[model samples]
Target: METESVEYVKQTMEYSRKRAIRTKLVNFVINKIWKVPIFYSESRAEGISSVQSDTDFMFEADGIFTLSNEGQIGLKSDTSVVYVVMDTHEVHSGYTRIQIMEGDWNDLSEFASSGDGLRSLCKTFGNHNSKYLSNILVKQFWETRMKSVIPRQGLKNEISSHGPSTVIRYAADKDVVEVDTLICLRGEWPEVAKEWLERKRNFNWPTKELIEEIKAIGCNLVPIGHRLSHGKELELEWRISFSKAECLLIWSLNGTQTACIECMRLFFQVFISPKFPDLFSSYFIKTAMFWLIEETDSTFWQPLNILACLDRLLSKLITCVEEKCIQNFFIPKNNMLDAKAVESKELLDVLRIELTRHDVTGEEKWRMLIKEKLLQMDKNDIYYYHILINSLSVSRHFIYNSIRSSNIKDSKDMLMQGIQELKCCNDKDMFSDVCKQLQHELEAILSIVTFCESQSDSGTDRILSPNDTKWVEETLNKYTELSHSTGKLLLCTFYFYIERYQEALAITEDVQTRYTSQVVHYTFWNRSKTPRDDHYPQITPRPTLNETLKNYIALDVVLLPCLSRLFRATIQEKLYSRDALFIHPLFYAFFVRFHCFYRMQNAAECEAVLNKMQTFVAENMDVLKTTQDFNILHLGDSCHQLLKKHTESGNYFKKTIKSLLQKGEF
Candidate 1:
């Protein structure tokens, strides 16, 4: 018996060790494959770490890895960059319709004298009205300015070039990794964008400084290229980009706003996109966020209002999704969503389904997305896997369905079976598999509940009664001990919408009690809290195995509404001050607290935040001390200057809060 027990323990140890190694390998491969530069990572736009692709070791033939300013991944000795996506600092979501500018300009004075300049040239090259320009001035631009020796490619390589835009395709990581480089200029900017340019006050985009210092002399060009759309007349259109200015705009976002934007993007990507297909691009979401910020004050963008802001954005998106409209930030005439509606009305239909609440005015979708339910009881596999498969089939069909005609009731019955299987399954391994597969069914269940209760969509709303809410709350809480963080996250979201803010905050804690639940969302938001916003929901986009880790689920933004109840007393007392450690988000929290102070017109607390921020950066931060660049110290000096500017201007929350405070209601 002793020997048998010892053997069992040895087997368990070996299994555990192998599992850890497998997990580590998956993490390493995924990060190394996709990670770009720390400052401007596309991985954040997509994913930080992923488990989507297989780690193919079949090609052990050519091994290499390397890194560069762009965070290139290849062999250490092999830093062969075939192309660079020139001026990547300017890259953003909305700038689409790539147009390649061509031809020569030996004489600028001829066109510089004309009032239209590049615009006149664009009309001459195209049939003179709608088309912009082609065969105009690209060769002269690249040839004269480039000092570096031009490369001559040797055999078996390809260059697909048009005007200035060239795609230099190259491979890394034993040629398993492929990348394309683009060369283009900022073009096609409208008058509204110029008006926006005049509004800039802070340390603008690095490109903005470049433009001001060198090109204030007013050199200009018309970039002409064909649109990416297929089967068109191929008219040359003048296109431009404002990516540089936009990057600076992104930098101005404080921690709260950034987090909120990311969360909203995640929501659009996860719930909205799957149902709507290619209709909701990241650009549409980002442009809406930017427009919303322009309409609000800094206090309105604070952590406490993150969800409220997202709610407003979503309400607006419902209009865009339904009416097939989303206006471009720089060009209001460019409705970004119009082109997305050509394929079918399925996306519009799917959105309506999800957004449809008894009280919510926006969404109304088809009941079921599957045309026919498959069942073959003679097969043992079908009998075992049918419930799981059918639930996801219905869930995904609505997402992938473009036909717009799938409203059969295949899932309603499968859902019942799934619940039954959960209750009956006793085999731990089989039960885990069912839970993993049935998570979709769970999400479908919760999205409906969330939609009904959130009251997020504007239109006279209906609230779930206490009994109904409690029932749903009890149902959500069932997974609290089941190692499913998503279920817990859903439960916390339920608590947040239902106004149980204390319980919502306690969901992240190891031990829970009424007294310990004092950690309100903004309490942690404005304080120098240890653990930060870690857990992003798993049900977002697609579920990968790695998201099961506890730290990956975030709940703070949803709970931020609790701040409205707590901020007045804290700002009034002029208490609670702290300095940030390196990367602890200490400075960010204090920045928020100071803004709260400013909003309340509490001058003393605002000054306290600035003094502490300055001193902390000067003294404690190792990175700042080593670099001696005060800007790197949590962007310290810039933030100080902003606060100082605000103080000097005496424009303290002039929008909503100040007006209310002056009226004695706040």
Candidate 2:
């Protein structure tokens, strides 16, 4: 009974050894054919290593074997053969065995080729038993398996009809089969996504940090996908395989590895194509402008590179804009009115600011062209009116700042030409139209001063506000005798400048009370005309003359308080000493400028007028600094918040002036 038990135990040991060998063989075969690294299972048993061992031989055969072991296979006709052994029972002897198959020369080679094809045939047949095989392969493997491992229908038969049965079967349970089948689906992803994910996975594409950013930007995926293809495809296209939401998420979060023009184009393409086709061109153009503008501010990067890119983008954008407008059917999804105008204005503001740093000839030319375009925009088009006006003003200021150092006399000529264009429009019927022309002329004149200052110290002194002053004088003179109420109001401004205060007061009062029915629409004058004749007199004016102009001028008088403050500040700053020098004439010039601002009833215009005044102060800042006078400082301080601070002062002044201007109010 003990002897029987020992024999049974020995038999069990043999069986375990055989199982280990087969397992290794299966693993080796899979690695060789699939090129997938073999990871041993925890339950796998160790096997003897030898070329003829089932595992070793089969695995190597996948790499180098040329024939099947089950067939009459030979390397050469009637001479050579390869054999493999699967068992090892003789402990002292070489456990692996080999056998040679001999055949006719042609038949031998044909057998070898057929035998070689058997391995592929087995893979096609597939094994449901091996856990290793079941776990490693994915659904994607099926396509490759079908293409290479399996022969076409009727062309090759996997089952043998009459031969040594080579089909080795190990019992596979239902659970094992199901596990193997399901394993093909797990840990599997699209090949395209896999490749992209592998490249950027660790580096972080569509990172969690970028979640909010991804959502805000729609259609950002196109560029990102195209970029992943290294721009082999147009970025505008979306791969149909990916859901739109997924694509968008990827796109918004993906950042370019570099920022060259090509990359920028691709980056721009992602969002532009999907979310904002209509706005794409304009935004790109504006972005280019911003880049160039920033480059102008500092030579932080290569300006030439930026400029070249800008030119390309702007050209493309211009074409797109013209095309969209022409098509008419291309309504922007954003419903933004005049997108170009908004972009141009914003970009131009930044550009104008940045231009203070560069002195390049090319930069100047570019700036000039941009300014010219702004000036050319229609005054009636409110979409661009204010922005264009601001741009023009800034450009004019920039030009004046550069004019002094300019070697070219043509600069001055060009500025004068702009003035001429504006003057040509001054004959229009509308008061606003005439005012616009005159204002443009004023801006042009201011540009001249800046231009002269930029040219040279010698030319700096030549910058005269006198030209604008002269124009103002002429405009006032021309309007003084005109029958129009606006013209008469303009004449009162002239009186204020020439220091004819009483006369100025008289004209204001006449229009205020006598013509309140007609001119009450002009709110300021009606308010100014309500008091005594000593300070405000009701002059003889009929139905045509209006109080609006007078009230406006009177309200303008509120600015005097600010002027008083500014003068006092100026004195404190020693802009002028009380007893040292004459100051009335200079103050008169300030008055005339203030009158123009007050008459317009435009806050922005008034601010612009104040800025010009500030410019004058800045021009003479050195002089003021030297004096350190209290009176000048006071004056400067007075002007600081003139319109805003002294709102009620105008009303009181209006009451006081009523008696002076009135024919009968006193």
- Judging by TM-score against the true structure, name the best candidate: 1
RMSD of 2: 39.6
Best-fitting candidate, scored by lDDT: 1
Worst 10 residues of 1 by lDDT: 365-374
How would you encode candidate 1's per-residue C-alpha lDDT over 527-621 as one tens digit per residue?
A: 21122222122234443322221222211111111112222232212212211111222333444445445555677766766666655454433
Q: List residue ranges in candidate 1 displaced over 4 A.
A: 1-132, 135-180, 186-192, 195-233, 342-346, 355-666
Each model's TM-score, in the order given?
0.32, 0.19
Error of 2 at 2 (Å): 97
Cα lDDT of candidate 2 equals 0.30
- Name the weakest run of 10 consecutive residues (lDDT summed) in model 2: 175-184
After aligning candidate 1 to the native by TM-score, how far in Å is the CA of 287 from where it should be?
0.2
